[model samples]
Target chain A: MNATEPKPTEEILESLADAKSVFIVGCSGCPVGCDVGGEKWVDEMTAAVRGAGKDVTGSALIELLCNKALVGIKLGRIVEQVTAAEAVLVGSCGVGVQAVGNMVARRTVPALNTICLGDYQGLWPGEERCGECGECVLAYTGGLCPITLCAKSLVNGQCGGTGDNGECEVSPDHPCGWKKIYDRLKELGRIDDMRRMIDPRDARKRAIPDAIRRTTRYALEVSEQEDPAPASEE
Target chain B: MSKLQQQLEAGKFVVTGEIGPPKGTNIEPVLHEAEEYLKDNVAAVNVTDIQTAVMRLGSMALCHMLIDRGIEPVFQMVCRDRNRLALQSDLLSAAALGIENVLALTGDHVVMGDHVQATPVFDLDSVGLLAAISNLEAGTDMGLDIKGNPNKLDGVPKFFKGCCTTPCSPTPEAQMIKLEKKVASGAQFVQTQAVYDPGAFENFMKMIEHIKVPVLVGIVLLKSAGMGKYMNRSVPGVQVPDQIIQRLTDAPKEDRAKVSVEIAAEIIRQVRPICQGAHLMTLGWDHCVPGIIKQANLT
Candidate 1:
């Protein structure tokens, strides 16, 4: 679950100060789990906005505010309110806030800071377990992410700070991440896996505005009907 | 730094030694080194915590053994693995087990040794580890709560903590920042990485003249030119000069040990006045240290 908390009432009002009318957007996914930006929070925000003297032209509890295509469709259903509003206030995480903004031409301001992806089954559920870096190294680490587990996030080697008790030399609360790997690999009888030096994370893969347009049946059908490259052009 | 600290505080040049514990349950190597060398000149012997990030016996357990054998074991704690919970408890455990001196280090990375796939936890660096020791000593945990929260009281554990630095770093200025930070974080004294170049060390000493802590210069006994060249290439921040490597290469195979001892003694004699003392790391050549000490007149 994505977690979020409501921004301070005063700060929200200050951001919405210049607008007489505004649109509120919340996520049904992550923000709802944290109770920071779901339907009730949107209702409470509407009341807070009414009290603060701004008109709530419209509000949306998007199924996934991060889905730009769905957002565009939902946004099309209420074009009038959106046109009437001077600005939009997003009550979800950073991704949600940006998603709504991408679908709208008007100014979009975030009302909630993007926390982290969380598990639903309550196994370290609400905390950020994975940083979701573009590359993943959990397979070699016995399902433990060295990038997220280790404190330094060193990709190649461990700093020799580990104590002998399989305890971390840094924080006393966490176990030595490498020791866990060692024991796991030892048990699996694959202690040689520890010698594999994971390559540095490729930054370009994580770069934003990147896209992957998967092959679809429609494209396949269109390609079937289309002629091959012209002989002269080829 | 407990015994060594007192000695340093008294303006006396104090020496300390280090021992790497055996991989399996063999206790003889550890005790033999302590009984052999630490009985006389060395103020304290540091029980390494998996030196080079390789698997080994626990430093705390070895410290307890050293204590049982009537030796002063400096319980070296590295931040590379343990978090505060383990570190704090180990501090209490060490004190309870009659272990006093503690050395803080940001251990070598796990990839350097036999275990390459190990997940390292360098939650705290060297300075952070030293600060953790201080936090534990102040009758509180890392979160600043009383040692035993919501329970009966126990005596506070006190430690004479020390930290390591690389004075001959490629960038000595940055090393000074760490040195000063370690001192600021309550490091009683400072031990350095292996020092082969005295000019660089004197330059380092000149830069950090105001730290006010005793600096125990690191002196490793180089057995051959191959060892010197390998150290210069493999070890982090340790640069063995070309002249020293050439000297080692020129020595006959039979005279290699003699040349190594002579070089170690000469380096000690050169750096002795500048540093508070030398922390000799034998690296399994404990027998050769006597020659180095004798030649340098440290006996």
Candidate 2:
């Protein structure tokens, strides 16, 4: 599930300032779990928008706003209110906001900023995300993924640039990822696990772009059994 | 073996110097500084690669130039601007140019440099780069041939491979862990980030005693009191103690260089008992290397 955080209040209000009426769309999936978007957030946002002196066209909490078909059906149920609004305020992750934009002709504005799940976690529990690098070294790192947590994504170990305060050299705000991994491994009594030398990541393994497609082994087996192609001669 | 490697192997407390290639084509001044001050004073002079990720003349080119001047150059290679193919090719190029010493670094982030918008290419971290160098030494490359075998090099070149560490990092355990990995990956020696506190450096040296690679503690000359304070605030893993900052502040403007050399020599004297050597990074003040070496009695 994608993580999300609320955008600044002033930014959201300013984007919707030109509209006479605003409808709010909240996701009940990941954002709801994150406590930034849900039925409660939708109600709060509607009240806030109304307080800003705009007509409230109503709000709906759609399940899995990332699913276009589901979002379309949910918006269809409130067609009258949706059509009456000049702009839709989406209180979900970037994917959910884009889904609402695709489904409606009205100006869709996002109310939340989609933070990189890789860089953030202590802010919310269980916020770690898999980068799908195709090769996992979680065991060696005591379940901490340096590829995602480290600012430079250094797979071997920490760079020498770690700050004196255990902050990343890139910025004082970011904690050193290897330090966390070191602490975790120490707690697990697996300090020697870090000694295992990991090879450089194969670029081919992560060459998959926006979409990853997989051919099922069942289909491949069935096809091979049904029609075997002639072998080519060298 | 390179002179630095030979000296380390002989149990000599060797000292290395450093020089940053100029931002433009006019490299005479820096090269002259190296020849004038560092040529006979230090074992080898390090030519930084886009030091701090700020773009400048390439390290390889400057390193080749150093060879012509009869100066031993430690070609500092960072994995921030090249992919695996380019890195391997450059390693071969460096060898072809008679560059014996190579320092592998993950490098500082690009955002810290002048060109904030430039992209950083950490295709291989320091450990991986070291492994690659080892592979090259073994007469093979880090690639598979058409027959799915390690590609063979026509005439493999060897180097005195070195890596860097921050002895004063707040995460000392983590830094040690990484250093252990670097040594495991084939790091022959280490030239560390600037170290000011000899006590911290001693502690770090004791912690890394298991790793047999020679470690050269780094010392960057403090040009002024303001630079010391700025380093404390901005330079990661480098903590210039308040007393040293006060020393720089108390020094008269004309005597700042003398005081800076004294501070550097003092740190070297303190750490010389515990470590293999010292790496003097004078920034633009290359003329101070001889004075520091003399004061530290490294000769």
Q: How large is the interface RMSD of each prediction?
A: 12.0, 1.1
lDDT of 1 at A231: 81
- As for candidate 1, its interface RMSD to one decimal place is 12.0
lDDT of each model, Cα atoms only?
0.70, 0.82
Query: What's the lDDT for residue B105 in model 1?
Result: 84
Position B21, candidate 1: lDDT: 90
User: Model 2: per-residue lDDT, tens digit, A1-234?
Assistant: 455567677767876776889988888877776689777898889888999999989889887776767778989999899889887887765556545755775656777755443322222223354444544455356556577678888887889777767788888988888887777767656677677788898765455322212325324534645667789898
RMSD of each: 15.1, 16.4
Per-residue lDDT for B206 in model 2? 91
Model 2: runs farther than 4 Å from truth? Answer: A1-126, A209-234
Report the lDDT of model 1 for residue A91.
74
Q: Which stretches of model 1 miss by more than 4 angstroms?
A: A1-114, A118-234, B144-153
Report the C-alpha displacement of residue A116, candidate 2, in angstroms: 15
